[model samples]
Target: MMTKFKRLALAAAFGTAVATSALAHSSKETTSPADGSTVAQPPEAIVMTFDAPMRITLIQVTGKDGTNYPVTRTDNMAPSKTFQAVPAALPDGSYTVNWRGLAEDGHAMDGSFTFSVGN
Candidate 1:
């Protein structure tokens, strides 16, 4: 038989564990040009860092007009905290980076951000 106080403590502990686990997925920590930034020269590559080791499943950079640039390759050959890719020449325009990754904890996550290139 569990006392009322003991039951409450157990429930609280369980809730905390669940909450922490829910936030264990890899999250983007930084970007090369930074999100919503404007760069003078076209970026040769796009790089992103995550809070934890992850495998990039899919990643792409698309122009605002829905044009997909040629991605040489996604540098996700290993489970790492960073992912990068060489993008074809980009014209002055707004671009968005969309990505999906699998975290070490076996959780799948996806996100996107936008940036612009200007002469």
Candidate 2:
């Protein structure tokens, strides 16, 4: 038999556990070119910063016309808080960078950002 105080304590513990789990998943904190920003020159690199270590599985840069641009990753697919990739020379256009990764908590995460290069 559990006392009323014991039941309340158990409920509090359960609530804390749920909240911690929810906050454990990593999230993108920032990007190199910045989301939704237009730059005068093409960005030399694509960078992603996360709140926690993440294993980046796939990262791609695509143009507004559905054309995919190749990006070279130097992270070797290791888990890290920051990931960077060098993209090929880009022309004046809007581009979207999509990425998928696995967070340190074993949860899958994915996000995308858009930037434009023009005067």
Candidate 3:
């Protein structure tokens, strides 16, 4: 038979483990120009919002024929809940945004999405 105090302690430990696991991987909440949508004009910067704060380790925007676009961070040192990158003028073509980052929970996460610039 388990004592009341032991049961309470077990419950608390379980809750903490569940919460930590829930935040193990951060996910993208939104993006500038969005994913899989066409835009008339090229966006000066690509911004990404995550469910939790993160440090962006790498970001890249690539176009067709394996062409890589220039990307720079708005802030270099600090981790943020939001991340942004400036890309060179994207000509009419399909492009993919690829990124890798560390979540606040210390997990390494990565994601990529595609979009079109024009017809």
Candidate 4:
């Protein structure tokens, strides 16, 4: 009941679905500061943990008003789990995290999310 073209299309769709399912992130992973946690006191650093190893290159924090937060003097980035940058003490305000890293499969990935400091 299926033409040759139809069969090929179905096979391709099935393959893509399997691949996407295989790459799904597991609960064992984490993102730094955990996507919307407020800090009581500016911690000594900003850190991110991944569900899997990652090769990160650029990590930045920007305020909602468009000011670039100073990465603390400590390097907040690591080759596998986190990206370190020296950010000065983050004042009480809302800030956004912008980051770029290489996924375990070797593809470059990037994302942004915002977090608020004190209430």
lDDT of each: 0.88, 0.96, 0.87, 0.69
Error of 1 at 18 (Å): 0.6
- By lDDT, the candidates rank as 2, 1, 3, 4
Estimate, for each residue in 21-84, the C-alpha lDDT of model 4 and write its tens digit: 6775322245556677787665556666667766666778888789987675244444465455
Model 3 regions more than 4 Å off: 1-20
Which candidate number has the best lDDT? Answer: 2
Q: Which stretches of model 2 miss by more than 4 angstroms?
A: none
With a 3 Å backbone cut-off (N, CA, C), the pairs that clash in candidate 3 are none
Model 2, 51-89: lDDT tens digits are: 999999999999999999999999999999999999999
Clashes of 4: 14
Q: How does model 4 fare in lDDT?
A: 0.69
Residue ranges of candidate 1 with Cα displaced over 4 Å: 74-76
Candidate 2: worst 10 consecutive residues by lDDT?
39-48
On residues 74-93, what C-alpha lDDT tens digit does candidate 1 reach at each position? 56467788888888999999
lDDT of 3 by residue, 1-119 (tens): 99999999999999999998986777899988799988888988899998888898988899977899998777784678889888988999989999999888788889988888986
Q: TM-score for every candidate vs. truth?
A: 0.92, 0.92, 0.81, 0.68
Winning model by TM-score = 2
